[model samples]
Target chain A: MRRPMPVLAAGQVHEVHGEGDDRAAGLAFALGLGTANRQGAVLVVRGALRQGLGLYGEGLARLGIDPARLLLVEARDAAALLRAGLEGARCPGLALVLLESEGPLKGYDLTASRRFVLAAERTQTPLVLLRHAARPQPSAAHTRWQVASAPSLPLEAPPGAQVRPPGLPMIAVEALRWRGGPAGQTWHLQWDEQHGGFRDTTGSLGGTPNRNENARTAPSGAVLPMAALRTG
Target chain B: MAVERDAARHGLAPGMTLADARARCPDLATLPHDPAADAALLTHLAKAMHALTPSVTPDPPDGLLLDISGCAHFFGSEAKMVAKATEITGLSTIHALAGNPAAARALARHGTPAQRRAEDVAALPVSALDLGEAATTALRRAGLKRLGDLVTRPAPTLAARFGEGLVLRLRQVMGDVAAPLAPQPVQAPIRAEARFAEPIARTDDVLEVAEDLLRQVAAQMEQRRLGGRHFALTLHRSDGARRRLLVETGQPTRDPPLVVRLLRERIDSLADPIDPGFGFDAITLSVKRADPLDARQTGLDQSEETQDSLQALIDRLGVRLGQDAVLRLAPADRHMPEAAQVSLPAAELNSSVSFHLPAMPRPLLLFDPPQGIEVIAGVPDGPPLRLRWRGAVHEVIHAEGPERIAPEWWRQRGGHMGEGATRTTRDYYRIEDARGRRLWVFRRGLYDGMENAPSWYVHGLFP
Candidate 1:
């Protein structure tokens, strides 16, 4: 919380990546933050990977995003995906655009990203490029962040008597790059699925850290934590 | 048989034998007459006259009628315009100026070899009125050989002698009345044109002319409070070939720059680019489809401007790529997962379709044709423990549903036989795999001992 996160600007490109978990949570969070009070729809361009139906509703519900306002476009390749993204970004009725690609996106270079940035800026629609296990590449994006799923706090059960399901999922987020500001600041935040809001667990929870705690407690647990099995 | 001028002078007339003509003049020569060649030459003349005025009608057996009222001034005078028409057609043409089209046609056809006015139409032959054979015969028997002879007779007496049609024709050709002329069909398009003294063979010249024409068209549209959704540019080449390029916008627009940009894109993307061949002599642009567009007062704010820019972008893309390439998802009326939604062309989206969020979580992507899978459920009526898809097995970590959905049995065939009438009842499950991937799996058919064993399919994925 000491290093305040920069606000997502209208008509800017932001890239997000996740490690070893349902990568959708980061996209849901970005979508929720980018499309607040904008009078348009959200378009999701999912490249080659068939993003199944289950996680979207759950993730949007967790992030407090309205499913009715979301539009999904399944593209065939990187080029088509990028075109869909840039076109969606240029649409005035679109409040935000979330793009997810299967592999290293081809032809999405500095020049292409710059064109996307210009279109987004011209239309004042925010664009979020979500990737899974992709290499860091140069782009005209305003910021980039790496989001990894972190362990949630242990559920309340008699410590020596029995273990219960974990409370909520937490994430370790780092701003890898941020334009107009300093980058490389990491924060531990907890996501309230019911209310679809984020909390700074490290700032308010006295920095009780480490995702390994759940793994350590799961082996000897009677009620395995529900959050531990909430991946995918 | 048609005789040449020289042959006619040697005491020879058309329909006479060649032997007789040769006997009359030893040097007489004859050639076969082709009606098709005459028709084709007439058509060429008609097309050539199109440059002078768009309303040009063909009078068969060797004549052309042109409506040159407003356009005559362009060539300096009616006489000069006729001269230009004769030059462009490269034919021996006789033309006359009259207030009515029938008088003009008759005067040109039979009044004289050169220019004739409406007053002179009375001296022409009664046959020139183009009356029926019976009326002309009756007029000839009554010694009314000239239009003057017919006009001098009492109007009622003439009408009683020859039916009302003859009187009507007489009045029409006499310039005392008006007769509507049916010319070649011309769609009334808002258009502008540019003619070059010399033909243009370069793409830049074509684009420049197109830009000017677009400006003119846009101004006209603005004056009419209208916007054009479809535009066409016709390039008339010097070699008589016409090339046309048509561009369509996603929505009505009167912006000249946007129209020119779209035309440029269409020209650049053409697989067979324009080959000026002998160069274009004239270029014309027409607004083929227009819609009434009211003036929009946009505030000097970011949101409205952004919306305008976005609309411009969509129109540009629609011209470059196809309009179908841009799509928006619309909910369908069917209950089946695959039929529950459809992709509609964004430009032509049906706004009345209300979007309904599924009561249960539906997959973001469903297989076009649901892929079959092997399910290993531990219980007879429970979710699968493991599913094999694409030769890969996924161990189910958790399972959610047995949401039963029945087939639309009203449409089932073999209604009378219960054995054949039974349709598969689907049991959908939202399951998580060991690798943390969630899947939508469905069991088809039932194990009620009245049918075959059930099958499974992987329907969709969760993002």
Candidate 2:
């Protein structure tokens, strides 16, 4: 196991403990959140459709940052995603290219994927990849994350209403790897309904390994939270 | 005696024995009196005889007997009819008329075929009565010599005493009993023959004449409510040369337009060097086999949908591709695929059009013989796992059950094959490849049944 290093993407939520500089410092140490070491670059946010991107955007705005700094690119196919990456660097002020990887199965062979890795290296444009296959992909991706959402607590128990309830559920983002950041970390946060935003959590939800219930369900002793884990 | 000199030189004098005559003149040619040859000659001559009524009988060894009783009045009188027959034979032969066979034999043998008066017969000896030598000798000894003398006797006693031969001979010449000469049968082949007014060297000229003749046959067929399937076109040249072309329809049809089309197609290939002579003046159309056309069906509008006549297609295709190039497939008896069809050219396919055979599953792609295939399978009698067909390997994903089609056993026991040729035991299978390519293949023989080894062959591709 490695130390936890936490980073906030444009569409993510990070929690702080207590209040003032001490609380902020404790939260920063615990989450490993700090200013990025590199210049203008890509910031990949890993999760599923179950964990809404709207909630993550609210957390970044809480840090008094403008959402316009990130470029959201929904690339459906591999060719479209690859093109979008190179085009992001050409924009000069662009920092990130967000690609949604879902719908239908298509794969890039080892040779084709190596070319994408080399292209990213030559242009010095960091690349991010998301996968939705049943098994954990062993690939040339820099890091992997097991992300999912937590169950929503009740606000008002409606009468015969089947709509989505309030109090946006918490997302359990498991940092499976990190090329530049400290790895083997997990975080849980809830979207704040008062300010119509998401906020960082204050308490640790099992900081160490607990394998009996969660590990029995999680693959490789790592569980993500965005939607209920359905094993195939 | 030019007659005696010619007959003597030709070795045919009456008293000159044919053998003795052949010995005196070493080059003298003699033939056994061939009644068959004589009959064949009469048969051909009968074609020319059609100009004078259809009745003409070959008089066995020497002459022709025609029942021209009613026919004689048409040529004015007996003398003129005799003169006409003489003219037709070119006056080199003889003709006769009498009241009986005995009398006619006396007149025709002694007199020329040109002379019809009884006086020409009067000078002939009593031996010319065609009676036996004994009867003639008895008549001569009794001093009752001529037919004129026999006429004075009581007719009943003459009949009671003379044999049936003498009675029959007497009755034939007297015209008491008709000889009933066989009418020369004109075969009248299903042909359209036209002799041109001017010798036609051009193809167009022949086609024009053919069109007219076809129309005539078409009208005749319409009257009889019949349709002809086979027709021959004969072109008579002025030099007595003949060029004939035959065409047949897939279905019986008497349409002039179709006949004209077939003829035009045939005439298109006729070369110019086959020159028509000075001119032709006669044309004829004859039917070979007439099929009754149902008036009920043909009365509908002339559209392809209205009738199921194969003639319309045969005519259209036969014109472009030669008649032989178009063929109709007729099922024949045999297990071998090659023997399964009697592939007759469209023209020859018409006459023997009806065929009967039991229903069976027939292959659409029937190779003369099947091609061998290389296959790697799970086992013998098991479905193929990988088939190397047409220089490529196709992996099988799924296979259907075998549909066993047995060979027809009885039909194969003839011709050049002695015995070693074994019958095929086919087990057909439907197999699908991994890439979704479906194929129909069969195993030739069972694993241990009878063969060098079991073999697999791809027969067809299934969609």
Candidate 3:
């Protein structure tokens, strides 16, 4: 007998079809299992750059996580990224799966994307993709966003400063479509090298406000307190 | 005086001195006597008596006791046994055996000093019974010089007179109390002797002699269902020269061909300037140790992939150089690198290695320990970045971790070696070189200022 598929908390399934619009940056706050607060899996695109990943690692670090997990792939192209990302299914202890690549991704087939969506839902590892804006996105992505931004400030400066170090990156994210959130969530986050993640005190007024009340208590002073961050 | 000493040759009187004997025989010569030499020769006879049994204990380098109950069968009869004793004693020493030790001792000192019987011993004087001088004097005063007079004496009267042991000795001689002499069980040694019609002269001839000896050796072992692990091959040169070659094998084997082959390699190389003068009269091959060959029963498809090939290689190397040059890594109860292994005869080593372990991971490449390597790094905690090992600089390209393994503490403590070398804590790191060579090195001891912690050594290399 086929077992009944489990119901997502109160049936919060989006069943999103295709990329509808990116006008207000479709913003959504997913209050599910954050990578830090609990044990889970997440998927990110290869070469998603600092914008999407910076916020992701920050949100994870903020959750006072039990143990955070990420499945990483350093692949040559989109096809290679997909192949590598699929290997994550073999890890029984897989918590969060992230896929990153820097190659052109403007021409992916939507028909295959639908299958990727179903596989993600079945495996329970929510897929996060960081692809080029020109790439034809698969119609299967539950939520689509054009992630772009900059660091809030340099290690020695506050936000909106030009004196930032050369290697430090910035991220500006706008959700193209969010199932449960406004389409225009934008957060200004700076990368904390010591924490090995990104942080944004600017609030998730537009996109996902994933951090709970406990995260806001972390000290964020003029000098980026490099504590509370670790990477393997 | 000399004239009278010469006349004594005709018939000398009882009270005579040496000056009178010289007067009677001025031409007669006398030599100083040696009683010790006689006693020593008697001792050697007792040793040769060991042919009878290992229990041939000498009664103070003179007397010999044989428990001949079982020994008599070897000579056919008691009369034959006495004949054998007579043959062995020849013209050298007096020998006798009776039911009792006192009877035997008395018969040995007198009564032709060669052979005697129980009834003839019964007719000897009462002194022949080994009575004390005082007792014999007392017996003579009573006019009882011969043992025949006391043969029918009243038992109570003799007991009251002679006080126990004399009566007991007489009774034991008559088979009253059993006098048991425990014989040492002599192991009939498994032996193989080859009598060469022609003594081996050339070194190669020794090989043939070894082959012949091996056949006899294997047959002896097969009869006993035993296998020899150690064998000594002896070449009896016609010139009375003896050269021995010792051959040892791993498993107990009775394969004559392999045994001959192994002994041949060693024997053929000997630099013996042997002369087949009259040709060696004998070549002996003897096994010193043997065990029952409990070989695993082979299945239908099973074959004895005997380690003969490896053994053959070892023998070849051993012949060219020496036995000490060959070594087999044997497990030993030690953590010290030098003591970690025992080099024993490959054939004699135990197959199963045992260790009492703290279970610290041992390195794959262990030097005779290692000369301490000077390291410059974040001390007390971090892995070394620059290591000076074997007088060469190696920059640690990448490091995985610090697997901290403490020293075995149950053993006696060694001196403070900072962190670890002999008995200090070891913070081991699996470090790789920029050239892709990996090393397992440890930082000795805590680098705390409390004591000395200046040593670091590269213990092993991991591929």
Which stretches of candidate 2 lie above 4 Å from their native place? A1-232, B1-176, B182-255, B267-298, B301-305, B308-310, B327-364, B405-423, B449-451
Candidate that beats the other on TM-score, 1 or 3, i.e. the better one: 1
| Residue B427 lDDT, candidate 3, scale 0-100 | 75
Quote each prediction's TM-score. 0.59, 0.37, 0.41
Each predicted complex: what DockQ? 0.12, 0.01, 0.01
Q: Roughly what TM-score does model 2 have, to 2 decimal places? A: 0.37
Q: What is the per-residue lDDT of model 3 for residues B204-301, given as tens digits with 9 covering 90 to 100?
A: 67667667777777787888788887788776766777767777765677877777766665555456644556566677888988989754555553
How many backbone clashes does every candidate have? Answer: 7, 23, 54
**Roughly what TM-score does model 1 have, to 2 decimal places?**
0.59
| Candidate 1 chain B superposition, TM-score | 0.58
lDDT of 2: 0.50
lDDT of 2 at A178: 58
| Candidate 1 per-residue C-alpha lDDT over B396-447 given as tens digits, one digit per residue, 9 for 90 to 100 | 7656677887776555664434443344778998776654456678998777
Q: Residue B322 lDDT in model 2?
A: 50
Instruction: Report residue B258 deviation for candidate 1 (angstroms).
Output: 1.7
Give the winner by TM-score. 1
| Runs with alpha carbons beyond 4 Å of true place in candidate 3 | A1-232, B1-184, B192-200, B268-281, B293-299, B303-344, B354-362, B413-423
